[model samples]
Target: MSDMYKAPQAELTNGEEHGDFGSVEKGIAGDYSFSISETVSEGWRLSKGKKRTVWLGILLYVIALIAITVVAGFITGVFTAEGDASFTQELIYNLITTIIGFPLAAGMTMIGIKIARGEDTSGTEVLAYFDKIVPLVIVNFLMAIFIFIGLLLLVLPGIYLMVAYLFAIPLVVDQNLGPWQALEASRKAVTKRWFSFLGFLILLLLIGLAGFLAVLIGMIWALPLLFIAIGVAYRKVFGSPHRA
Candidate 1:
């Protein structure tokens, strides 16, 4: 554990770590304040030098994704070899892929969480969600629908919801939460410092973009940092009552 990753005393607007204040409505953040620098630094500390494991995990995840897509495509080709596949058939195939692939996404989160917790794990741990696939699939499906609707109605709301629910998958992976419980916990945890967390997300995107610019191979490292940063945020928000 680096000094930077050490839990610092929570700073309030009044400069008090803990105090009895009345129901005074804070301006941007409510009870909790988020520091973008602290969060990103913590993520880097967790991610640095762990690229080999993260890379292996990501490679396995990609292989699984490609395998699933190819299998689905092959199945569709086999069934529709006599004629062009119907639009309905294509839609159903896509739905099937989404359901199967979404749980794999949770597996990556599980790996990142384990790494952030300093636990030694194998890349194959990315398949840990197979035992608890149902809840993750349901959660991913509902999140997709909600996010899509929010995007359709207003762009800002969709982005806000996306950042707010950022920890939902990790919560499901680490805490074994059901679909709704994970989402609700994420919302409650992020709602207090939504804007700050949104800034943190933007910075991470920029970092990833920089990696993509570095001949694209840099993504293997950059993506892991992003995921680890997410794990850091998860721990900050929900790890223990002391941090909470």
Candidate 2:
């Protein structure tokens, strides 16, 4: 496999270089990830089998996501509280720039390390990825611009771009690709199983609605398990991790 598609930890074992292109169904994500797989699983054939690691990851991530969502809202509120130039105004600006402001590189790099090491990963892993790689964070911010422009044209394309590059951060960290290349590699991986990917995308949205109606717990519990299933399914359906 090209280094562009291989993990950083890839080594030529006695002159044979094979970098973790495991059975798609079995998961080649050992290198690292920042996924919307939960969102993706709503329609895909992926299965979220219950496991200690997956469950624990889900529980912790759900709590963290909820906390972050709440905190971001609070921050926005605080920004808005202080009149015209309040934090809200500043927040709107920051949110727009989060791709650039936060540690996009740090996230990818850390995930790379974890995946290479085949370690259990969590939200903190993402933060660590950001902490380690700083420059990519700005590029991520710029990529957001392209996404916004794509969205401005219409919603479908925006969603397409979103799904296409959902795994870009992971690809970049593990493979050392530049932003556009990462986007291309990520898009290729996802599109390799277009039907399956699309199917899961639709399924997850429906599940999300269900989760909404059932209250936040629906999202909390449904999301992780569903995602785990999708990730697993991606392997089975595509038979090749990189293709989809």
Candidate 3:
């Protein structure tokens, strides 16, 4: 495995440099302005020749999700006599899926990062972040709780947070931050241009909707485009791993 794929041995300090990649702290504090057109175009450019690998990764990810749901449903079914799981059982099922899902989600983010950085991917990159599974799960769990609470209080805070923590998983995978650290870092960095990020997400959602309308097979293309775009955004927010 390359250094890019490996987790950092030491916790990143504020403004600490990561070799030729530059300081993430600097990137965070620097200009948050980025053109969605350029970002999406760059993503499309990087994704051009890697369609097969990207599609395969998405397919595998979907399969894994279905498998997890099926297994969870089976286990929860054993405890239910009415053919419907109780609230507790449903919650348990969701918890099981969420715990198992985050690492895979991180892997997907890593795959995006890899594409953004022009690194090679084997499609099996979807399975690669199990090493960081603990932090991934914890960060996601905390994010879910916070977002839920925010939603209960007022709708806007939850919406704000939904956009604010976009880079949390990437932070964990790329910068090797702990759970809380990753969440905070993502929130703070994205807070600078929260509306812009929201616009970016809206644009991505539009793209996804367009893809879904195209018989869903277009998602193989759209999903990769979205991830690569997100990867581009991640690199834009943090610093790029490669030297310019």
Candidate 4:
């Protein structure tokens, strides 16, 4: 089995080698940190020569998304007579998609982590996290509610939570932590360097935007690069488990 599939034994500390690729260097104040440039550069490097696999995985995910949307729409349509859906129908549709999307998103994160660990992947691994659907769904739902409430209070709090909780799902999946525990762990870890993490997210957003503007084909590369970069950041902050 690939090291990616094996359960990690313990969290890696500063200066530990992630795999055969490289080691996580120590940052200021003895806290874990990652360079935005280095992280993205590593993402680009790993993404290189793996376009087909990455694209295939994206295609599968997109198809699954479309399938769910169609199914949900069809189900919603059964309740409405007009072409437009009722508010309740729309709510139902969103609920369905959101519930299903959590695990899929986690799967993508898993694939990114796998790639960051220098393992080969087929992209189809996006379907692998359904086994942990309950916590995955709960954590995401709670995250959305908190972010929504924070945004309602003021834009800054919402944005803060947005960047802070970025690793909640990954922690849940990788460390097998419960929903609230994952949220707290992610929030606390990210709070240490919240601004830096926000900047990293902004840079990634820019990269994703650039890909979208490049005639859309760039997404094939851009999407994988984004996820891989995120995975790299995740490893930097929390460290990886020991591979079997």
Candidate 5:
């Protein structure tokens, strides 16, 4: 989960190795040589499989969810009380909704990274990750903004943009990069994959549907596992330490 364990690609001038696990098994194309499932599980195994972190992650997440829901509900109630509203009013509300809980989204990114790395990050630690990941956070926000703008044009194009940038979070979390760099790398990473990475997207969308159908209980089990697998992917694509 933590990208600290990769095997070296080439030694650095100071003798430290560049973060890379050579020859992954489940690499997207011929580029990567790694297995997604195995790396994530390895991360979970390292985290000690404790229930405590899951509980905390879930609690923080739910609280964030409730806060946003309450805010949206209040806004909706206000609009209804005032009678019919303009499309512009509704549109403004929607954008407000998107911006409201950026902190929480950022938190999830950190928690997912920690969970994958088998680390014990308190909620405080999540905050710490955010501090360290400010570049990532800002880049991520800007990217989302770009996607939202694209969505304002045509819906399908927006969806395409979303998928293209899906790897931004993990890229930043694992690599500690700026937004542009992360986006650049992610674009390359996604493009160099099996069936254009559409299969991966479809699988995740299905998993999301299943998680929704299960009343989110499935996510408690699923999130950690997914992170682990991605952690493995990180290792495989990027190299060891990140590698399982």
Candidate 6:
């Protein structure tokens, strides 16, 4: 990693950068304050001078995405290639893919956390979360089920939960929390700043769209920015991990 990507070891001593959340602000949901602008700005600070490293991370991510898509497509092709596949078959295929794809999702989060922490990241880091596979898969599965149920009730609640639990994966991988614990922690951390999180998400989405529009190659770079931004938000919300 270049100096741009290297965070000084001294800064790592402070486990929680946001300080005690409840001490800062209170909300109807609970206490905990977050600044969407500050979080995004911190993300930019982490990413600003690290263009080369960020692009490398993105390239690895894109390659991984392509690989996963190809494998999923191949599996689907096997069952549906016969042309007699039914809705049930497709549903089963989707579930299978979701289960198998959990590791990649976790890997992506791990990469994001690493980048945010200024740790060295390489293509191999994409699969670093595989060792903690069970909890990662369980956490993701539970989050999806709850979010879907919430969506069934109303659009707003579902969207709320989506942002509420956005940090579950990072919590799981970074904090070593259980599935339920991670989900609940993520919910609590984001509860006070849900709207801000929404706005942040929208900003990232627009950035991603811009990447797509830029000759389709810009996503290779934009993807890292998105991940780093998320990392920044995660840090701002939950604070950094305790480094011994």
Best by TM-score: 4
Between candidates 1 and 3, name the one with more favorable TM-score: 3
Comparing 4 and 5 on TM-score, the stronger one: 4
Candidate 5 residue spans exceeding 4 A from truth: 1-32, 40-51, 68-92, 123-163, 172-176, 194-197, 207-217, 238-244
Candidate 4 residue-wise lDDT, 1-244, digit = tens: 2334432333222124443222112211226656788889878876665556566667778898988888987887733546667778888888888788888888888788766665546678878888999999899889999999999996889999999899889888887889998888888777878888898999999989999999998887898899888877876776555532
TM per candidate: 0.80, 0.53, 0.81, 0.82, 0.59, 0.77
lDDT of 5 at 182: 69
Poorly placed runs, candidate 2 (over 4 Å): 1-81, 84-119, 132-136, 154-156, 233-244
State the displacement of the C-alpha of residue 180, model 1, in Å, after optimal TM-score superposition: 1.5
The CA lDDT of each predicted structure is: 0.69, 0.47, 0.75, 0.75, 0.54, 0.68
lDDT of 2 by residue, 1-244 (tens): 1123333333213112323233322233323222345324322321222233334444444555556555665556644455556655666655634543245334433332332332345434444444424546644765687789889998777777777665555444544567776666566666665555666667667886787789676765555445444433332322232332
Q: Which ten residues in a row are the worst by lDDT in model 4?
A: 20-29
TM-score order of candidates, top first: 4, 3, 1, 6, 5, 2
Mind giving the per-residue lDDT tens digits that candidate 3 earns over 158-244? 999999889888788778888888888888888887887899999999999999999998887898899888887876778553433
Report per-prediction Cα RMSD to one decimal: 6.9, 9.7, 6.3, 5.2, 7.5, 4.2
Name the runs in model 6 displaced over 4 angstroms. 1-33, 49-58, 61-81, 85-93, 217-221
Model 1: per-residue Cα lDDT at residue 86: 80
lDDT accuracy of residue 160 in candidate 1: 72
| Candidate 4 regions with alpha-carbon error over 4 angstroms | 1-30, 76-87
Total clashes for model 6: 0
Q: Please report the TM-score between candidate 1 and the true structure.
A: 0.80
- Give the Å shift of residue 7 in candidate 3: 25
